[model samples]
Target: MSGADLSRLSLNTATVKHADLRTAVDAAASAGYGAVGLWRDRVQEVGAERAARIVAEAGLRVSSLCRGGFLTAADDAGVEAALDDNRRAIDEAATVGTRELVFVVGGLSGSSPGGPPGAATDRDLVATRSRVADRLAELAPFAEARGVRIALEPLHPVFAADRAVISTLAQALDLAAPFAPGAVGVVVDTYHVWWDPELRAGVARAGREGRLACYQVCDWILPLASDALLSRGHVGDGYVDFAAVTTWVADAGYRGDVEVEIFNETVWDAPVAATVATVAERWERHVAPHLAPSPGAGMRLLDAPGERP
Candidate 1:
């Protein structure tokens, strides 16, 4: 894959979870990836400053930071803490040189920030979603101040009870509509949105609204792992029709980095280099050709003139 064109490819660090930040950055750059989507844990391993240095030295851009939201806290204290932590994440994202801070808004009322990983003490999905919107409003201005956008990521409906209350692109767009497109945006991850009947329309709306912040890819493999969160596979490994989805994204005018963010045990256990190589090959065969030929590049940010990147 040495001579392959990976100009728009991004390797999400979670796809190679076991590697240290330096190793992952080096591997991604060496594999011809133009960017990398970083997980907060990996960024914290060497501290945000040093992590930024590693990525910069490797010549790879930071596509987006993996996560900053879990805003469905049931109490005021929990809510405040979630907000503070997100503010920290925003700072981390800015320091790391990415304008998008991916958000996994909390699940039903009692999931993260209070209970066990997926335990929901209360099932008021409506209230939970309301709280997420309120929190986003509070954080948007702060995020915009530092040249960062809160890229809300809606999980697949299967994870709605415990992982995310925002389970569709339409819902994410609604939540983001109240803020500046640069300050709050939506992420279109294939693993999460591929099954939606409204995906094409939603992608178009995102494009029209200038809210398509990030685009991630992975297949929805069957025989889901005991932990459904790890069920993601490479681009062409399973049920996803990459060409179709990629075409919709291209038509929507999303020219940002297309990140490959797999979470499967098999891919995690394989050699990092081999996994990246496979992603590059699968992307070349299934996704590359579907992109726009030479439209204007880069997603437009908010009206905050100097910060749009």
Candidate 2:
């Protein structure tokens, strides 16, 4: 990707969840990572305001917020509460000087209610996904008014019954369709979408529509973890075709940070600093080579900490 250094890499805090906000930011900056993707839980520990200051002081940009969704509530109050929470997520994004707030839109209504996994019929799934669209109708404007974009993230289909109903890049793009591209967009995460047969086309469509908000990278580990949710590996640790998929995304005209978001327990147990360094090295090896040249060359300035957007 045009003699790229570590300047374009971002480390998602989940890669080092063992560390607090300050520590994660420290490790990110120390490793020369340009940005970090944060989760709301991490921000709540130190508060968004303080967290923003810490990141600023470390000279690292907050690439994108982890989440702001769970729109599967069955009641009006539940729906309203979900929307309100997303609004607050938007405010947090603004306060932290970020433009993209990632949303992991939940699956079927009551699908995983009461802290246990649940199932739904086709009708239930359709209705629940429709509700998601309606909620977006409300949440998108709220975000746009404050100069924020709602980045809808489609989790792996394995999560379709309980985590996110949106299972593919095409689905995410469709949901983001009816709104201005800047107001509602989609996250192209390799861990979740790498297996999609239409991945290349979906990415190209996302770019053509101007709805490509963020590009996340992580290996899809096999022999899934007991809690498969934590099965993510470093960029090259598993079987994902880093070069092919990333080349598709880069060729689609995305010029933002390429975030390394791993969730493996083993990686978390290692020293956070070493973990960051290893991720950087792996990214440069397996991910960087596939990236197309940056879209605008040196014309885009690093406006927020170490990020371009």
Task: Please name the candidate that would achieve the greatest TM-score relative to the true structure.
Answer: 1
lDDT of each: 0.89, 0.84
RMSD of each: 3.8, 5.0
Clashing pairs in 2: none
Candidate 2: residue 47 Cα off by (Å): 1.6
lDDT string, candidate 2, 1-309, tens digits = 223487679888889988999899888887788898988999988889998999999998888988899987778998889988988899999888789999999866766622465453233788888888999998888899999999999899988877899999999988998999889999999999999999988987777777889999999988999888889988888889988888777766678888888888999999987898888889889988878745552233232122223
Global local distance difference test of model 2: 0.84
How many pairs collide in each candidate, listed in order? 0, 0
What TM-score, to 2 decimals, does candidate 1 have? Answer: 0.92
Predicted model with the maximum lDDT: 1
Q: How far is candidate 2 from the true structure (C-alpha RMSD, Å)?
A: 5.0
